[model samples]
Target: MSIVKEFKHVNYLWEDSVAAKLAGDEVALLIYRSNLLGADLRLTNYGGGNTSCKTIEKDPITGGKTEVMWIKGSGGDIGTLKRSGLAGLYVDRLRSLENVYKGIEQEDEMVELFNHCIFDLKSKAPSIDTPLHGFLPFKHIDHLHPDAAISIAAAKDGRKITQELFKGTIGWVDWQKPGFDLGLQLKQCLAENPGIRGIMLGSHGLFTWGDTAYDCYINSLEIIEASAEYLDQNYGKKGPVFGGQHIESLDANGRKRQAAAIAPVLRGFCSSERHMIGHFTDDARVLEFINSKDLDRLAPMGTSCPDHFLRTKISPLVLELEANANLADIDDLKEKLTPAFEAYRHMYKAYYDNCKHENSPAIRDSNPVVVLYPGVGMFTFSKDKQTARVAAEFYTNAINVMKGAEAVSEYTSLPRQEAFDIEYWLLEEAKLSRQPKPKPLSGRIALITGSAGGIGKATAKRFIDEGGVVVINDNDSNRLESARTEFNTQFGKDAFAAVLLDVTDSEKIVNAYNEAALAFGGVDIIVNCAGLSISKPIEDHTEKDWDILYDVLVKGQFLVTQKGLEVMRKQALGGDVINIVSKNALVSGPNNAGYGSAKAAQLHLSRLNAAELGGDGIRVNVVNPDAVISDSKIWESGWAEGRAKAYGVTVAELPAYYAKRTLLNKIILPDDIANACFVLVGGLLNKSTGNVLNVDGGVAMAFVR
Candidate 1:
């Protein structure tokens, strides 16, 4: 095995060639510098920082060049930043806001003023840090929340340490929330410290500046590198970290097993206010800190950086279990979650009650975004998969910050009142209000069998459009890879996970579900969409044909659903299972004994499972459709010709013939079946289960009596 290595310093990625190409363009050079800084987490976390450049642009009304400050906009990552993602504002107009800035009490009123100062009519929305950048004297500034910079900024004696480490090269300012007031304070600090290159905001982050882009980028990296080296020199000098690691970490496979076993329950608990997607990690650092003695003491202090707390909430909820717990201890861990969660809510509400300002927005969700397990790993939950994943990344940043501060000096979190004020600030509430409402299935995860193409693909796409995550699968490797790429492109990388495996193989089924558990928290809806067909008269039906049909249709659904139960049952949150049965399950005909009987078995299996699993809050239902010819694998696999032969019609006429026979004369399609599946599980008829919905255009014989 190869030894793993850790990077101790942020790399200098500036290339003179790349900069030379954009020689005359200041805004383009600014974007290039921002991307280089953002490419490394050591510089700053994803979406955690902002960068800026001040250049002269022609005033729309004046017909003259005026100073304009271009800064990173509200919600995009700096690493992937583009010119359009910047909010270009008139610096003169921005600085003019001091005329009406009625002191700290009226600071929030300043946000509205920034909109009136937009230089380009199409500029992106400005962030709260706009004033911080516009008021600065430097031509280029980097306001980054680098984990290393934050470590020194968050220490108990941070200001004193700043004086000692950089010898006044970087000055310090006491903590104040970002706004008009903080901007003025920064201006004052620069005035007091002659020849200083940057100002380190106490318990927040560092602000570094330079006359040119390269100077600014290099200055930022140099400070971060020094901070990291200082911490590395002193870490554990006092004693072994976390009192010498009281509990041992589970082995690699056991860590995954334990993480998967309890992810669903943790996800459900975190979804008390709204459904949530979950992310799990057992990185060595996470395991190291979680298994330590100080886990209980340090977790409650909350994060010092506002960027960290904004995504992770004030603090994480710790789910404790016996020392050295392994996969067999999952039941005990599950039992601990309920009490731990309930207590966490109580704790958070009390914090709000104690610290909320009169004008603060109403209390938001009390559920912890991050959860910690002593012998296992970390789990983070949020309204979407990406957010949850990012929350975990942020908490990991917090852990690193904590470790660094503790090593060099006492680690101090933001004061309680300050944390609350920043968390529930009114401006933040307004920003949240402007966001679009979540789709009905925003936080759900569905696993659809045979989703490489056809009905399965359509159904998965529908679920995804409604904001559901999916675990898609097919036995065909080529089709599965194509579907994976297509979905990843159309929806997003986080929208779906594709697995290639046979449904009838139990080992493969178990392995596939494990992948689903890790990709998402677990499954909340399971669709048995994999199927095949065989058409033969009773006399001509050979045993091989019968076995193949049953194996692919009946046995396949049973095996897939059986494995899904393990995940759903543990979640304890009510779930939905939609079976894509056929109308032939109810309406019998000649030359279709093998396929039709298997469909009937599938229908009965749904009913039986509904009866058996209902006590566990699982609803099993069937969607029976006929003649769904468009994009159907079953139709393409010789079933169309066989059905046409039996009906004494050409293959091309099957759709018209089937539609004509129906009362509504509607042609059934894969999309129609997809809609039916969505109807059953999309929270429309939550109370109705053990039922069959016919998407066959009013087939009277297929109707349930």
Candidate 2:
């Protein structure tokens, strides 16, 4: 069934309206409403909605004050807008003026009036809808034409049908010119229906209002949703099937070979197809669309949401791929694509020039928003794959809706200039602007196993603080959950991902790496922090304990390192891997024979991997830290008492006794261990590989390196 339904009572309001009403002595109500409006629009995409509100008061000096309206300034989404987002205007003065102010009907008069009165007390011009909001009677008003709204409206004689369905229950406004004229029409309609809860502007959008902000938001969502349910009962289509035939054309090596082999054939075919290729299609609609003689009615195949413009650009590629045609030659394909690409560039330049005003910045030249090759699938551009995926997702939704709209009747879009205004507006440009880079690792991906506590979490935080994207893996699901939530709060959902899996399991390790790759692209760095410690005299050490330590400390690190090497090798990129061994590898520790021997073996493995993988530009290193005082279970057991007795110290003071031996006189912290790991992997040590770095506060002086 179609995925269109009015938002339930649960998620109707995008923000807490109670916060808007609670604007105290410091914060103004207008500013709160502006912020709330911005947030809502930002959360929804693809021409989903707009918002506005009114405020009144008397001037303290004249014992007389005038009322004013402030609406979410146009062309800006709530996600990035500030209080300045609200365009201010004289409410009573605007209300007194007849809706038809201009003698000649100007298409954008409402938008123009908004601009005319709300002068930028600061230097910028106000939006064009300020006055329209000023003329409305309600304190708060919101309008949205979301995907859900369209889904319900995409049926036989949609507007007339919905009108008949709701009869007297819902007020209806015919699709008039939007902006000032539409506002005026709405004002008159509201006047006639004084107690109307909500109104559906036929073929336009839904309008909801309330004495309080929350009620208005809720009422708007409820009525629209109710209408959608009514429509669903009468007409529904099966949900779109997403799974497609898995085309396993090539593996990594196979793709490279295919690309080389097919490039020449494709190139030759392009020479002929460029001339006669426009006339073939697998689908009838595709053929009709390509052959349409009316250039003026061309559908804009981009996103419905404005933010999508940043990712997918303003259009899509129209490819002409036929089942029997020759797509085998790369050069021929290039020959055809070259002209279409040039045409796209010329069109883009014209679009940019037409949209240009005195205040806009130049558009980016190389990043074409959409590429339409006749036969191939559409491809959206993003700085990274994650963003492009979001664009692709929105494209799917938008294409379906546009198709449904066409099926009912003609499918039109927002006016070109209006879309351009929003598309290239300086304020909107600022909305998509990124923050300054955090560190060398800002966009790089890293995987750290056993990261929920101790060295793992410490290392994860250090990476994050430097602007790195991190994926934490641990066997403890509960700990991973807690760590994931806490870290996400600090770094955004994109910056951190937590996986629960045992690194010793080869299949699990491979799957975890795959997940991280999907989440943040290929992994760039790996920190194997999942080792173990079992302290016991050689005579007391059990085979089971010995096996466990070796399995986790040595085997886990080895398997993870192997995966890291494979990924880095394929990418043809340089990367780092730091193994958390121990100083015990250099100097033997009594009653911890199992822990010491396992660490020693892991250290040797690191050196071997480093030597072998260095040819592929992968650096492997080890951090040897001594006697950490943190949550190490071995340090807390009675074995600690045995070690303390041997050293002539009480169990309580054993940690202090160990700390005093360090030359730095300060206890070695996990942060210090993490810092050491960073130094070895970071660029400063770019030339160094297969090195064992010590981080024991000078407690261990070894030549084993």
Candidate 3:
């Protein structure tokens, strides 16, 4: 594939002549170039590369010109980079520190020195590679870990191959752990070879620089394209291939079902008490790699690059799957997979024990982050869906790089000791330390039905606030999209996903549950909050009204709960199921026979499920809320007027009328129900099941015994 250069897009940034006339023209250009590099996954994986431009800016306090390096900041992707993501450091101060940190040995101390050179006190911490950028005297610098370059850079004779391909156009540096000393080495290399246009660091990545952002970007593209051309010339025809001989019997749906069965067992094995989500892909290249005869020898050869060790473990776990395995029986699948996982853990522990040093931090979990199953292809696990996707993408790139290298010569990896050092590097650990403390449900996934508005929306938001990923399902497509946009704006784009589903339709419910499982590893919490209130006397209630109420409140809850049970059972991870019932379920209300009776049936169904699922450690509970008239969709459907008439009060006075009747004289809000749902599903009521939590401001008649 050719590199994409949209020069017109770059020119448009300066078109607002007024904004460009003021300041930050260079910074804006750097941001645009960085985003362009980040946009191509082949050029850089998520948050994997750094870029910088050297410019002069006047100090706010001193009113004197100062040379500064505007470099990409930590913990943000270059694709969506903004002004805030670029850390500006005083170049003179950073360059002068070359001698000050000359003999410092600790990694943390070098990082401290790097932070001290920040020109803006409020700016984010500069990238760990800032020194390498600062040491170079170029007007602009770009460092990328492109897969094509990595295939060439990570080989046994990487330096020789790079020199042969670029022919003095690029310089080479042997692999050294990145820090102050490596920065010094980079400077010396440039001083020794002044005519080279770029530097290719052994087993690491490539560095290119020029006088302008456009020049540097083009230089990077050219170098990478040259490497790609070399790979094509050598092994273009004999690339890795996958055949369908083994799975010729199964259709696409059958293959997906097989993966669904196997994914949960793998996810449960990888996860500890803290949940982890798994993503699976059987892409042609991945399948070819897994099904190869030499997989056993090639899989454990270490990561494609050093940075990948941070996301994927040092190596992937290679598990063998039978050619025509029967995955319909979960017990049989678990039986076959359990021993393999155990062995993998033992092997990982041994690897860590042999390489650990005195200063090394505690060994990370022994579970493999990436798992390769012969028939299932690759599965990547992480605390969240986005991170899992990132891991999967990097591993896929690694496979391509290895294939290219293997086509030329044997694939080589860093020594185990060096891999361990980079894996435990302080800079990598610091990124994790910078995050806030995780909430109780941080990595769990929740599925909330009827989430377009009212109690369901509130509950979905609450789950997201607690760091849990959510799936919001509603039959109304437009309302669901609107709610999804709002949630995405308030929380994050990946915080929740929206599915258009009518819960009463069994087929739709099944598809929605499957969608949730595919998006996340599996569902850990199910909140049954989809319902419509019908305020009519028993004599006035029609057969159609009865069917609708029963279908939504009773049958819908039954179908959703059953689907949730199937996922929980397959995952073998304990989960929570919460039914949003009503106060009328306990105490009969006038003109509310249809709604109240259906709710009562739902409450009973939850109790029965609690008793049955307790053996599997799944907790089933119910929340009974009273008179949540304000901001409720049930009220919008004429329930407000009906309830107001029943209470002999106007619609505006209904809330106060119900509030005065309660012992606490408080109006029940949607948030109150949401809080109760959180308590049940967030593990606060872990030991209690089949219990009803009251959220009605202490109603005298509706209080649970």
Candidate 4:
């Protein structure tokens, strides 16, 4: 391995007056900041890394003075880190220890150090690398198995390979278990060459430190960026060629198609952008790693580092492709994928059986983190979007490292049990246990009218997001197709349906509802958002306009609710009906004779239904939205105007205007409406019914009767 000379890195975050007493005001800030840095770096995708700060402290009870250490508490993300996230430890205890009392079998030693060395027994387990970080002489130390750094390190004869690429610049370390023994080894190596700038952990990561914390963070970033740049320069390739089978381009239509596909996946996975599926395919690494076969083995070593280890575990699916192959067809893709998934589960169970505590919860499901379908490439899954995206990046980086390591010698990873222990660790198990799955709505069916617009669509999305299946209906065939494509794409076929039928037609409404129940088992909720408006003063109101408005706004709602109540009461399963009315119903509005009258009727209708359906356990409510603008008549009319008259000041500007009308100065969106629906049917409002909820932008404060 090539070792580079050390250089002095400047760290601006440290105070020169930092005192020897640990937990003192100045040192407390330093320690807190150091933990923040560790959490930030580690919380990054494939960025399982650690940071530590050394300080001297006086023991309060014993009245004796000693050096103390504080490290990142185990099990939390750096992104959400605070002062409380740190685990307190006795530095003197660690520094003075001559030798590990327990024999140094890697796994056992790691557990012991974590349990004994850390003074905060109730806190999260100290990272397995605490000993290594503690052994370093630097006051501020940082270690990260950055995807970028490890990707380069995992190359065959990585020392020589990287030497050729980086020259005699980067320091290197052969892979070693991270604990007391490794700590001692690093202490000796640094002593031999005190001038080294950083340590490159072979098949692992890179380390950088300074006398202060700022230098440590910046140094780590610089080294990682350098490695990333090197790979981009040497190994980067153009986008994959699909053999002229017409993979969609990232155009407007392409984006719509992509959104549809992605939306369903998000819904089915019960993930929000912040939860599990966000950023899943946003990174280049997802695409690159999906196209490779390095995910076959089970090892806690992971794609890159520890944080992202949960994303892809240490294994992904491996697939091989012939000269001619098709990746677009779902059936063809599944043919290659199904068996691989089965094998991965089989292997995962074996690993779990070998590693975990006997009482540990059995593996819930055997879904591979990364799916490598050879010709079709690979994909990654996680509990959240960021995690999945980060894992994908780590896999790409790891693939590069593994390929290089293979070039030097056969690239191999740790045994199955070790990875299983890390993957199914008690700490991680706790995280999974804390997540409360969406209830009551999970697997239930709901039908939403006017679902192609903001509120209806948003409500449908919310229901689907909460694990309920939704059948979205719209009069406009185009909009219906759009909703269908969007929901199907995001939730897969399991969570969504799109029907093109106008609610004004009573026969059609009944038929569609029957069909939806037939298709998805049974219906549980109905949101009547399919209403029409006619802006005309009483004197100017036409017979046609009045009739059409009443037909859709009042008649349509009545017909659908009537049919829905009948079906719901027959099934004897309590259900819900939400009517989209208007806040303007409470206060009068000019040029809204037909629309206002119809909405007023719809509101009273909801109360009547609520009173009648109470015994059947059905809930009926009205949502009076004042000025929420989505893909609706107002937005379309404004867009079609093309600015000459500025029909409604453009769809984008509508929110600000609406917000200004509200006391809170807040413009509500579809999601706000969805959240309200979540509360209503979510069984939180179990006792109340015949109520009108206002989702308007503070237009009026009068409660619905």
Per-structure clash totals for the candidates:
0, 36, 0, 34
RMSD values, in order shown: 3.6, 9.9, 3.5, 11.7
TM-score of each: 0.94, 0.65, 0.92, 0.57
Q: Model 1 off-target regions past 4 Å?
A: 1-8, 15-18, 323-334, 649-667, 697-701
Q: What would the TM-score be for candidate 1 when compared with the true structure? A: 0.94
RMSD of 1: 3.6
Model 2, span 110-195: residue lDDT tens: 34444445422542344444444555688777766544444334333556655565665556666553455666777777787777
Off by over 4 Å in 4: 1-47, 62-65, 76-82, 96-100, 104-125, 159-185, 188-195, 214-259, 262-304, 317-361, 371-380, 396-417, 426-540, 543-676, 679-705
Across residues 1-705, which tens digit of lDDT does each residue of candidate 3 receive?
A: 123454311121222343344345788878877887888877878988789998998987699999999998877788888999888999998998866674637645777777778888767788778888999999889888887888888877788888888998899998887777778888999999988999988778889998877678788877887887787777735444321123332445655666666677777888854689777777777776777766777788876577676788889988767635777788887888888888888887787789887877777788888988775668898988788888888888888777767765667877888888788776677777888887878879899999888899999989888879899978888889999889978987667778898988988887787777666777889999998987877798899999999999999999999988888888888899999998888997799888888988998999999999999999999999998875677887878888888889998898899999989999988889999999887766789999999999888787778
Question: How does each model score on lDDT?
Answer: 0.87, 0.58, 0.81, 0.60
Model 2 weakest lDDT span, ten residues long? 273-282
Residue-wise lDDT of candidate 4 within 299-323, one digit each (tens)?
Answer: 2344433444555665664444331
By lDDT rank, best first, the candidates go: 1, 3, 4, 2
RMSD of 2: 9.9
TM-score of model number 4: 0.57
**Model 1: worst 10 consecutive residues (lDDT sum):** 1-10
lDDT of 2 at 308: 38
State the lDDT of candidate 1 residue by residue for 1-705, as single tens digits: 112223459877777878889988989999999999889987888898889999988887979989999999887678989999999999989999999999998998899889999987778889999898888899999999888888899988888888999998998999899999999888888889878989999888999999988888888888888889988888889787765797888788877877777787787788788778998899888888899888888999989999898999989988766534554444665676678888999999999999987777888899999989887889899989999888988899999888888877888999899998889988888889988989878999999998888789999999999889999899999989999889988998889888997987898888788887777888899999998887877898899999988888898899999988988767777789999998999998879999999999999999999999988889999999898888777876778888899999999899999999999999998889899899888878999999998899999988879
Better of 1 and 3 by lDDT: 1
